[model samples]
Target: MSTTKWSIDTAHSEIGFKVKHMMFTNVSGNFEKFDASIETEGDDFTSAKFDFSGEIASINTGNADRDNHLRSGDFFDAEQFPTLTFKSTSFEKESESDYKLTGDLTLHGVTKSVKLDVEFGGLAKDPWGNTKTGLSATGKINRKDWGLNWNSALETGGVLVGEEVKLNIELQFIQQ
Candidate 1:
């Protein structure tokens, strides 16, 4: 197998996250617009090239007010940053189905190395005769590390938002 180029099927993909809110429950959200391109030597993903970009203003949490707040400087500050991006640094195959993917994630003017556990979901051909593949990546990072430090102090006890932000990505790619 040679180096194959793949384009993300954004319609069938998702970039989402979850964070602790108010100290008790989790607030789940997804980015509505994102783009990714992948290059792999045949079916071997152990070493590949991956690049991803997500529009910060397209965040959806099902609440208009909160969504707007997220777009403000208190959070992503979409006007200034516009987008969050990731460029792969390395991929290490650990087991038959597990891979540790390390990448440079840039958000809010901060770039940091992040690791994700990627699970190759196999491949298949669609009715349209297109070769497709599935992948899922999950990771976590401290929000404050990226300069997204704005938060409120609850009068009762703890803070309003937690530091850890959990990331979950489900992607489908079609060979192009």
Candidate 2:
């Protein structure tokens, strides 16, 4: 197989995350707008490249107040840092279906190296005769490292929010 460029079908993909809120409950949300591009040849994945960029202002958690807070300086500061981005730096194959993807993640002016567990979801031709591919990835990062450390103390001795945030991404790409 020859290497080909694929554009992410954002309408069919999702970027989501979860964090511990109020010391015990979990708060989850998804970004409504984002873009990604991928290049790969066959299943070897040795020559693959991946890039993703997301709009911070598209965050929606079902509550306007919470969403506003997330976009404020105390958290993501969407006004100043309007975008979050990631670009693959390396990839290590662990199995036929699994891989470790290392990349630089930038958030709120902070950039850090992060690793994600990637699962190849195989490929197929859609009803429209378009070749499509699917992938799912997951990872965790400390929000404080990204300068998002805003929280309050709880009477139970824990902070209002957890420092670690879990990211989940499900993407579908079509040959372009």
Candidate 3:
């Protein structure tokens, strides 16, 4: 079989995350600008090669102040490390509609191997006759592991930000 290429449909995809704030409520955010690509043998994702990236400057959490703070040296330091990236090392099918995706995630100048759970959302053809596939992936990572250790001690006794960040990604790829 020959390799097939797929490019992300940005309009239908999002790279989002959630983290606990003040040891209580969860704060949600997402990158407004991002891109991804995948290459596989035909339509089999079990041995696919995936590459994804998100610009630090595009981080949006609804509040301008917080977004600016995240781009500062205390967190992502957008000036020094402008983008976070991921390159897959393995893609293994776990079931009919589920798979395990392992990759090297580079963020805040640090690179670490991370694993995510992926659910295949099947495929479909658009009105334009373009073939597309959808995927939903979830994962968790410790911010400190990627050198995003900035935090403040809350007056109420807990920390201002949680260490663990939950990843919630939705991807739509157009076959090319």
Candidate 4:
């Protein structure tokens, strides 16, 4: 078995999330800058480790006002917490190409353990002769758990934002 190191292809990868807004609509956004590193021993990812970091100031939701609000003390508090990070503690193979990755996720000012449902898309050689790998992961977490509790109660019912935030990650990596 050969040992390999992989680096995330930022240009072809995305880190995004969606949350229920005003109890009726879904607001989604993506981080423009993030990177991850993976180390593994052959096909068995048991010994693999992962580290990822994202810039909080690069958030884009297609709306400037919303973006600013997200960056303020109401949500991410980007000025106080300049980055969000994740470091894998363990990875369990659920199937031939699926895994459950458990790790520490840090956001806002709190850190908590989270599990991500990961799908390994296998490996292939690109047209340019470079070997690459693909992966997709998703998870959900309650924003309130991370201390992001700003919200407004609607006159009719429900809150301005949902507590649960759905996270989605699509990644492509180049073998190094």
Q: Please report the candidate that would top TM-score against the real structure.
A: 3
Give the range of the ten consecutive residues with the poorest summed lDDT in model 2: 39-48
Model 1 residue 44 CA deviation in Å? 1.6
Q: What's the lDDT for all of these models? A: 0.94, 0.91, 0.96, 0.91
Q: What digit string (tens of lDDT, one per residue) describes model 2 on residues 37-136? A: 9878864565678999999999999999999999999999999999999999987788888989899999999999999999987778999999898889
Q: On lDDT, who's better, 2 or 3?
A: 3
How well is each residue in 1-176 modelled by candidate 4, as lDDT tens digits? 78889999998899999999999899999999898989999745667788999999999999999999999998899999989999999988889899999999999979999999999898899999988988899999999999999999999988999999999999998988
User: What 10-residue stretch in candidate 3 is worst by lDDT?
Assistant: 149-158
As a whole number from 0 to 100, the lDDT of residue 31 in candidate 3 is 99
Please state every model's RMSD to the true fold in angstroms: 0.9, 1.3, 0.6, 1.2
**Which regions of candidate 3 are displaced past 4 Å?**
none
Name the lDDT value of residue 110 in candidate 3. 97
Candidates in order, TM-scores: namely 0.97, 0.95, 0.99, 0.96
What TM-score quantifies how close candidate 1 is to the native fold? 0.97
Rank ordering of all candidates by TM-score, starting from the highest:
3, 1, 4, 2
Question: Higher TM-score: candidate 2 or 3?
Answer: 3
TM-score of 4: 0.96
Ranked by lDDT, the better of candidates 3 and 4 is 3
Tens-place lDDT digits, model 3, residues 1-176: 99999999999999999999999899999999999999999988889999999999999999999999999999999999999999999999999999999999999989999999999998899999999999999999999999899999988798999999999999999999
lDDT of 1: 0.94
